[model samples]
Target: MKKFKYLFGPVPSRRFGLSLGVDLTPFKTCSFDCVFCQLGRTTNHTTERKEYVPMDGVCNELNEWLSTNGQADYITLAGSGEPTLHSRFGDVLEFIRTHTRIPAVLLTNGTLLDQPGVQEAAARAHIVKVSLSVWDTASYVNINHPHPNLKFDQLVEGLIQFRANFKGRLWMEVFLIDGMNSGPNDVKKIAQLARQINPDCIHLNTAVRPVHHDFVKPLTGEELNSLAPLFDPPAEVIPEFKTTRRPDFQTNEDTLLEMLRRRPCTSEQIAGALGLHLNEVSKYVGKLLRTNRIRKIRKDDNVYYCTVNK
Candidate 1:
């Protein structure tokens, strides 16, 4: 199969179900070099918004996928880097809206939400989820490591303004890192700011994979559960859910690798999704682990296996 340059997954997202992904920006091209970014440190850190990649190429791949009867819960504007960093991101969203029945979704860091163009573009999505990981500028610097040109206040203002007029479902994702912004008082203040945005709901998440900094740590389900009520309403703990139900397939490492490329999966998740026994999953997983083809990440109570670039 010829690979789509700008299109990637109908990956299973715990929050968004099976979602077809659109990568608008080049790898690591983002406004914020967040400490807990699983893709590691950002190489191209900038606040500049332009056509990062050819927008027509993305639309072409999307049209091809749709032509083949691509099925997914959502057509997601998320992959590799922040989608909004691309000036034509709105056009891509518009393409999905006019071209398909599947709803479009934007998973953004909320940095550019204040820009009039950005707000107008993002409003095209059926659902937009923005990030709110810090309460103050200091904490924003500590956790998100935003570009020097980007101000924490500007981030808040943009999110608030975007929410004020967005008719679609708005959601806020609070990424909690231990000893960083997960403290009770910190969450309380963060909650106050989150309420100002008035999202339809909030989804509390933690770093599930290895991060750029050692200080950033993933929270336990218990810790996340305890912190859920700190928001206006309790937040749903992000968990690895079944991506898709498969009929049956023999144990294949390539199949496992392809699945992990989409989203991290537990041994049981791999087994259940692939219709393999736990022992069979362990065998392939162990081989991949030794070769560094895949890595293990502890998410809540489960051990997840995900693809590694190296």
Candidate 2:
């Protein structure tokens, strides 16, 4: 079986089920070094939107996939890097719409929304899910650690602009880090932003998977649920993280090695790719390292796997 470097998931989503994720920017390239980011640290942090990957190449690949699979719940633009960082984001959205009837969604950190070009690009998406980690500037700096050039005021303005222009649903995602954005004041500020943006829904999230910062912890469900009522109706905490059980979807050691050749993956990432249990994937990865099919790289005590050819 062939594994894709760019396309991942049809994984479980709290908002959209079985989302087929498309990576627009290069791996681990992003504007923020968020405390709760699932992908770990940002190796390259910049606000500039460049042609990180050949837009036409990615568009062509996406067309082929959509043409074959037809549609899933949502065709999401998000991957290891921030999607808006791709200068040709508008073209990508247009390309997807031209080829498929599936609703296109752009999942972004919302830092770039203030840019006229970014706003123009986002106008084409069927849904926009923007991340707002904290309400105040200090909290913003502490929690998200966004690009030095990004301003919280501008971010808030841009989010409002998106709400004004986008006809589709606007879903706001708030990631609460313990003792940081989970307090009463933080919750109040977030609630104010929610009312201002007036998104279709607000999703309260805690770090469930391993993250870039060792200090970040997932808030208790009870803690998250407490913040739900502050926003307007339809605003609530994420229900639960659910995994699908499909026995037919399976990957072997050889298949896993092939995937590592293209991208470095943690045990969790490998499991996500294969749709297998983490413990099961960890056992296979451990075995492969002993055989020297893969090499291990340690960053901040976290292990990542990459292919090593003999």
**What digit string (tens of lDDT, one per residue) describes model 1 on residues 156-270?**
9999999999999998899998888888999999999988889999989886644545677878789999999988877778765542343222226678999999999877688
Regions of candidate 2 where Cα sits further than 4 Å from its true position: 248-265, 268-300, 303-310
All candidates: CA RMSD in angstroms? 7.4, 6.8
> How far in Å is the alpha carbon of 111 misplaced in model 2?
0.9
Give all TM-scores, in the order shown: 0.81, 0.81
lDDT for each residue of candidate 2 in 158-212, tens digit (9 for 90 to 100): 9998788888888888888888778878788888888898888888877655454
| Candidate 2, lDDT over the whole model | 0.77
Runs of candidate 1 with Cα error greater than 4 angstroms are 247-310
Q: Pick by lDDT: which candidate is best?
A: 1
**Least accurate stretch of 10 residues (summed lDDT) in model 1?**
242-251
For candidate 1, give the lDDT.
0.81
Model 2: weakest 10-residue lDDT segment is: 241-250
C-alpha RMSD (angstroms) for model 1: 7.4
